[model samples]
Target: MMLDRSITNTLWQLQDANSRQVLALVQKFELPEIVARILVTRGINVENASDFLYPLIKSLLPDPFSLLDMDKAVDRIILAITNNEKIAIFGDYDVDGATSAALIHRYLKEIGINSTIYIPDRIDEGYGLNTAALLKLKKQEVGLCISVDCGTIAYQPIDDAKSFGLDIIVVDHHISMESLPNAVAVINPNRFDENFPYNNLAAVGVSFLLIVAFNKILREKGFFISKKEPNLFDLLDLVALGTVCDVMQITGLNRALVSQGLKVMSARKNVGLRILFDNLRILEKPSVAHLGFSIGPCINAGGRVGEASLGARLLSTCNEEEAYQIALKLINFNNARKVLENEALSEALLQVEQSVTLNTKFIMVSGNWHQGIIGIIASRLKEQSHLPTIVISLNNGIGKASCRSVPGIDIGAAVLSAKFMDLIIEGGGHSMAAGFSIKDHKIRDLHDFFAERFADFVKEKMIKVDGIITVKSVNLSLWNQLRRLEPFGVGHPEPRFIIQGVRIINPEIIGTNHIKCLITDGNTTARAIAFRSVNTKLSSAIMQSGVKTILGRISVNYWNGREFVQFVIEDLMT
Candidate 1:
């Protein structure tokens, strides 16, 4: 159900000549002129068009040693490996942290170091490193503790680990604070003064650097017995999953990670991945869509609704039976998550409609929402209302909130304001997404804080569209044209098209509440379906309009082996 869309509606007209210009520049280097224009409009030009369009291995990859702490991080890890010292990995329960933990653990084991893996339980303990877990590692007399995906934010936790007489090496990719933590090596690209080539690497990418450095150290120590230092590109499969699931921008290194990662995933080396593909009925050749919607969610489900360790174990294990068991458990958890997400989203939407006069650019919803699924719910609400949203789950006297943002709104900035004024107990994230905690009674203060800050920022902002297109461009060729922009996300989003004045025929229902129709914009005909818009004004227009229909920012789709375009229906003018 893809469409003939442009990156910007006004930048370039959808035509074959422009597409051929784009095609001649890249591997898909021979697409329609409209595609070339869309690609160009999405910030791809003649010089870098080939790179963006193809995402080649050489072009996307950066030098492994480009990071500042690469040598230090590698030397220390290699020393630990040589001494046969016991190493424990401390990781968060989220997908990024879990996957990074698993990736590092797998690489270590492959190099014959059976490191002890420790993932903090979300239900029992909170996000970052807990003192109790460190004490347990102390009891085990572990020599080194490698912190993955987290710990950059934990000023006290790192200090505590050191006080407990433990050696710590932090390998994370989260935004950092001004003061650094006390550790043997802190390998984070976001560290202040870091001129690292790419700040967009996920935690897994950071872990990959440690692996690269360790290999370098090993080779320097006369242990060089590798074919091109063991292609780390293969690990992109894990990298892609974590990057996408964690909701990082798809530009620079992050884009390369997913682009190459998708290729490895389609090959399906990991047994647990094989089961996931088999059960989900995903084809051998997976796509960005498959990774984003299919694989990422199932892995995230374990952390959100079940055990975060489940995803890590699944990715790390070689035991087929264990992998299968974990996959089944994750799938079941994902199923349960869907129902919970539906209920929470529905309630949030209803509340938005009821409060039509809320004078704020951001919406904050607090209730007894499930803490694990709050982030996804926040994302849904953000999309549903086109406003920054924070969904908090209150338990006892404490509340945990997950935030999702919209264009022109900095949710992170909003959360930071609440934190600064002592409204929220703790808060952290980027401009677009964030997480926070507040005392039960402080919810109102936090809301007012966010509302005020958002209002101030709103005056200087506007809706930032990714790219635009139209319905007439829908064709078999455009499907492949969209493929040129593989691994679409945060920064490089999928192409969105605006199709208006299209006639609808025999509007039959599909999905739980969807529609199947023939959408004809006179010269071009595309099979269009609308999801969850069955009874909305969009559906009503298709039903009642005597002439034609208007469409806006619609996503291309394919269902039951048939291609089509679908509209989100921004508005209708008849």
Candidate 2:
């Protein structure tokens, strides 16, 4: 029983002309042919296939005046909101910088244009354009500054806010660094010339298409109201919870911006996102995995454990009892960011189980960890050891990092190889995520510069297995036709199914360290479980196997209650 079903060259397969054009458009939209072969192996081709097989609110969105410098970023923020000046907006405290800085500070105060936002405090000024808070918004003479979900890597605070004159713009979506940050207008769709046809938006859907191109340039300059187009779909539930808590990739116009931003977050209509969806009791209909593991970790737990301007003042508060006391102080700062992300992910998993010869293939641990929660413990060890990590946080000597990658590893090119070996005074991010700054003995030169950059970027790269399905296509009508592919974040995922043979019946050891088997051999009967599979000796050697055997599984279950499946027995033979 030396199980290792092999699959993991950073898992990613499926492209036989995008899986037979996603099984002939899920048999021409009759769907459920295993959710049309996982939505044509997640490319959703065939002319955008009925918008991911039917994610309506009218498809083919785009026209926030067709993107490219979004009409010069909405004609220079409506000429700094009709010259009364002082605008601001900044943002970035997670959940797509607190819903794109609370939807451009409530659409510049619903056109009366007062706007003032800011945000930046991921543990007091981290993540994005700082210059001592742009020199206190250029000593509050601000004038213009837009940003939202971060300025495409500021480039020295947009060159010190244009040498303290101001008029920046930015509205980002991340990937883009060839040198484009003297910001005067940069609404990114990962801008590289911005064809704007769509390349995965969600910095609150590019700041709600720069507030629908600044309300169509304040409706052809009639200035504010003639009363008509201002319903930016009621701020698309804060741009679908910051595009599914900044993971984006739900697909094209971010799946119509998180399916109409989860129906304007289930009609709770602002009031501090309905008191943060009533303190996460979640008064129903929010999904995209509850806007990424529950309201994007309670709005990134006030920028990782309190006061990153309390999730941009509970997403620009107005009332409802001061958004229920900042939604109970952002749910007690997300229970203190889950006890500071599980005490630095249980001491970085006990220093990755007592440093097994510094497990190479890219990993750069550090100690005293908490650079505002070591990027959620390098995203739970790049989702449990898929690889490319980086979780620093020294003290007296500085350090401070936070990475997390796996899919074909590129944690911002392994922290830009410690900023090309200058010992990283600041690195960047992209492929899978990044962030840096260093010098506490630059941890073995950032663990030998990510082991010579994952010996040519993540070993040889191959094990991604997006295939293997059957087991009567895990029914419930293929989970309600994979719920019409309703909102599956970061490049549309959900659809795995692996099941091969079956035979467990009476396994046991339920919760408090799970097991719960129940599969049957007679053609296939289900009910499997694994979650920490009862302290592993391969769960009592597959419950003391006597005869029957053959296994592999992946279509997991338990939507909100949490009984995951996608059969993770990985591999076993008897």
Candidate 3:
């Protein structure tokens, strides 16, 4: 039996279960028991084992019409396409929003429609649709407007758009409130009244579904009888980028979408993405990590500190010359974002250290930090402290704050509640992350409320280990087994395994705060790395210990067409 672990000292427990079902699955599917165990852990039974491992788009993709108001959304787009009406696409500043808008814009352009793209400024306009923006679209005579990755909560602005005789379609995946905005059609799986099976789709995934519905309608009307129909599968590259960047759960439909999308991305079909890949000098095929860490951050930098329109423009533009120029600009923007993030992060860390007596379960740091870097600072601090963190940049009398949270906490719901209660001027976000603006006077009250809400759950910190394996088993075969479960994030996380009684050799500090070491279990030796742990207990334990156990994930490194297995250490026990 397992008991709840203490908050101070981390507990390491083996993840074991009855093996009858796993063994049965291994025999039936002719798979290794190690792979079967992982599949079972993710709730994959005999009926869906193979499908889960190798998900196909045709098998996993749901009917687009199942989502509420999907038909209505498709009808409006068809009307615009047939009548040659001017349409505008409004997207958020993040990667999900940029890719969502790009997916639709590209499809429309393929069918001889030219749509205007709008991305709201993060600092000036904040998130979602504003009344002023809608009025400006009306001035431009845009008959229809589609808001992606945002506008689900902008009731007033959607109402204003209606008054201006502009039809609006909302293709978003954020969790909706009791009532939705007055848009012409809102196609969201997470809506209060909807019953769609897949609710954790990123905004770009929802946007892709809208296009699927749009294409089906056009085909029925013989819109593609003369011209070759656009292959919708080609758009998966954007969908995969948006889904991974937004940190959507990779399961069911999402798994198929991303698996297929990565193939499309590796083909270098998108000129802008190809330029980014070439700039990075990545020789291997694109993986989930490449999208999440490398490509996503660079694309998001365009929205964070550089021009807000750069990301959407880069993704949608078909002109090779324009794509190359925008890609280089985005790379420069990413470098700038890093500098600003480090400066603000140092200040935020100091603030955290000074507030030891605060009675809150969350970390709240307020400073003269750059607004563009606060969100990244919040995310880094949250990871370091294993607690929900909010970084606020004070400008004039009001504070703009970005929040990041751990599992089991709904920071976005808390921020939204504060907004509803008038404690915050404005704010909205998802469960794991959020943003808000608050007056200086209400800071104390916000702290008190957070303490009361989160204190009871603060003691639940335990590091979960999937299974223990011999170091000798960490070879090419094990790597292949792990690769079967691709595209891990959020809900379906990457599995971490434990290797027992390993001896470390030649441990040394590497880049920044990372430590690199060679480990051996008497039979096999492998390279392992621990990130951002230069001076931590793991560093000392690895160097001084006689024998130790380490927790990590396995990855394959390819160089000059040769492949080898590598261990990425996440935690250690002496």
| Candidate with best TM-score | 3
Per-prediction TM-score to the true structure, in the order listed: 0.88, 0.34, 0.95
- Residue pairs in clash, model 2: 9-463, 11-464, 12-464, 22-40, 553-567, 554-566, 554-567, 555-566, 556-565, 556-566
lDDT per residue for candidate 3 within 1-574, as digits (tens), equals 2323322256666566558879878889888888788777778888888777788998888999999999899888888877888999999999999999999999988887899999999878888899999899999999999999988788999999999898899988876777899998999887889999998899999999998988898899998899889999999999999999987778888988998999999888888888888786677889998999889998899889999999999889888889889889999999999889878877888888888543447898898877778888998888777789888889888899999898888887888777777888878777888888899888888888877778876644566667888888778888877777777876677777889889998888877788888889987899877777766666777778588777888887776788788788877766
Cα deviation at 196, candidate 3, in Å, is 2.0
Tell me how far candidate 1 lies from the true structure as C-alpha RMSD in angstroms: 4.4
Better model by TM-score, 1 or 3? 3
Alpha carbon lDDT at 331, candidate 1: 90
Candidate 2 lowest-lDDT run of ten = 1-10
**Candidate 3 to truth, TM:** 0.95
The number of the candidate with the highest lDDT is: 3
Superior by TM-score: candidate 1 or candidate 2:
1
- lDDT per residue for candidate 1 within 451-502, as digits (tens), equals 6677754422222332344565565556666666677888876655545566
Displacement of residue 254 (Cα, Å) in model 2 is 3.1
- Global CA lDDT computed for model 3: 0.85
Model 2 per-residue lDDT tens digits across residues 1-574 = 1223332322333334355776777567666555565555556666778766566654567677777678887777767766778888888777777778888888778766777777776555777878888778878888787877667767887887788787688888766666688888887776667777665666777787777767766777776456545677888888777767656567766777678778777887778877777677776566777768776787778777677767777777787787788778878878776776767777788887676443357666788866778888887776656677888888888877878787776676556556766877876766777787788876786687677767765443323234555545544555555666767667666544434455677777765667777665567666666665564445766687454333443444655765443354543444
